[model samples]
Structures are given as C-alpha cells and as structure tokens.
Target: MSSSNSVEGSYSKRCAACKHLRRRCAEDCVLAPYFPATHPERFECVHKIFGAGNVARMLKAIPVQERAQAADSLSAEAYWRVQDPVYGSTGIVIQTNQEISSTQCELAKIRAQISMYEAQMATEQQPPPPGLPQQQGSLGSQENMPMFEPNDPFNFLN
Candidate 1:
C-alpha cells in the first residue's frame, strides 16, 4: 500500500546525525553510513566528544574507503573520554602494556623452570663418572640439587 511505502521511505531518509541535528539526511550524507537511525547514541556520544562539525570535516578529509574504521575509532575514543575524562584512551593503553609486560615476565619464569627441570632430568639419566662410586639414594636427593636464583632476570626475547 502507499501508506506503508511512505513510512519506509520516511524512516530510511534520516540518519542518526541528521535526526539529532534536526535536518534532512541527503542521499550523499557522509555520516549516514556510519551513524544509522537505529543507533542514535553512537552519533550523540561522538558529537559530544568531537563536535558534529569537526566529525563531518574529519570524515570528509579522509578517504571514503577508510571512513568506517575512522568512525569506529572516533566512537571508541569518545567512549574512553567519557569513562576517563583526564587520561582517556592513554590510560587504557598504559594499563594494557603493563599487563602484557607482567605476563611476559611470568612466561619467561615458567620457561626457565621447565629448562631447569629438563637439565636435571638429563643429568640424572647420565651414568656417573667412570672412576666415581655411585652413592645409594644420593642421585636425586634435595641436598645435592643446584640452587636456582629466584631474583635472576629473564629476558623474553632471548
């Protein structure tokens, strides 16, 4: 029916940005693809952090093919800015870097432990020196174990 067609036509014509701006969304509107009418909050957040004019100018400045990625980046930055007014995304980056470093250090330590165990096993399997008499129950005793320094620095790259 004509009524249903008109409703669909009206709904598809306005994007979130244009609707928020109280203007019609032209067919060539750059913001339309990124900010559809269904998710007005995305456009609102981006608008609040980076003004509508700035967003429009930035989108226009970039290549059309890269606009979607730019929009996502802008939205994420806006979200971070809202969550952390002072540091924003920088705080998140620093925290993530610290966590990665901690995990790398832990992995290095475990690898070192595994290496030590393998060395011990290899030594245990080898026959004693030709002239030396083997002591009973002393082959794998704790007293003869080599001391491993807990404070040894382990480089993940090495």
Candidate 2:
C-alpha cells in the first residue's frame, strides 16, 4: 500500500536562532522555512546590525522571567508571570555560531566603503601648522598684531 502521508519526507531550513532557543520558530522569523521564496531578505543579515538589533530589541521587550527552564531565553520576571505547569518555557535561549551573516558581495561593498572613507580622511587631514612661516593664523598684519606674542613656532622650526 502507498503511505504518502507517512513521516518519511524532507524538511526545509528553519530559523537557526529560534531553533537553538527551542522556541516556536513559527512564521515570524525572517529565516523561517521557505524563506528564500516567501521573505526574500529585506536586508542582508551580514555585518549590518539590523537583524541583531531586532533580536536584541525583542529580548528587551520580553521582560525578565524567573524560574526559567535551562533551555529557554526569557528572563526570570517574565517566566514567573506566564509560567505554566504543563507547558515549559524551553524555547527562550537563542544560539548562533556566526557573528556576521552577510553575503560576500555585501561584505566587499562595506569594506570598500570603509577603505574609501579612510582614504578620504587621510587626504582631508591638514597639518596643524602647514609649515609656512609660522605667523599667527590671524589675518592682522605685523603692526596690528597683539604685543603679547605667543612663542613663535617659526623660531623652533627654522
């Protein structure tokens, strides 16, 4: 007989972070199943802080929970508030191996941008004293200059 509905089948990639925490990684996370088709990235999760920021923000919103399960990620205060005898809060602890989840092209783009900025900064930097006859930066002529002379840098440089 044909057992098509049997448990023998393939599975899709689930949200890694949610899976680690044993949380109900339902249809909420951007990396949920069939993500490549359904949620074609709003933004790459690479070095960009948007995804990390989102998770950090979510952690903040979820208040602390006391007497939490070892696997759950919720705070103690939050756990106590909604703690149930049957349903344990095991899916709270989120785990991840990667720091930056961005693509190669995007990483290159960010690096290039940083390099350009560094170059620009180096070029834009002006010497404290442009090595000209170290006169006071003031436009006042010698006759009009203040009598209280700050030690002239020209004396030392020359």
Q: For every model shown, what is its TM-score relative to the native structure? A: 0.67, 0.19
lDDT of all predictions: 0.90, 0.41
The digit string of per-residue lDDT tens for model 1 on 81-103 reads: 88898989998999999999999
Candidate with top lDDT is: 1
Instruction: Give me the runs in candidate 2 sitting further than 4 Å from their true place.
Output: 1-102, 128-158
Q: Identify the candidate with maximal TM-score.
A: 1
- CA error at residue 78 for candidate 2, angstroms: 38
lDDT of 1: 0.90
- Which parts of model 1 are misplaced by more than 4 Å? 1-8, 63-66, 135-158
- TM-score of candidate 2 against the unseen true structure: 0.19
Judge candidate 1 at residue 40 and give its lDDT. 92
What is the C-alpha lDDT profile of model 2 across 8-113, one tens digit per residue? 2211334444433344454555334222323223122210223434544554455434212311333332343344323333332211213234465679999999
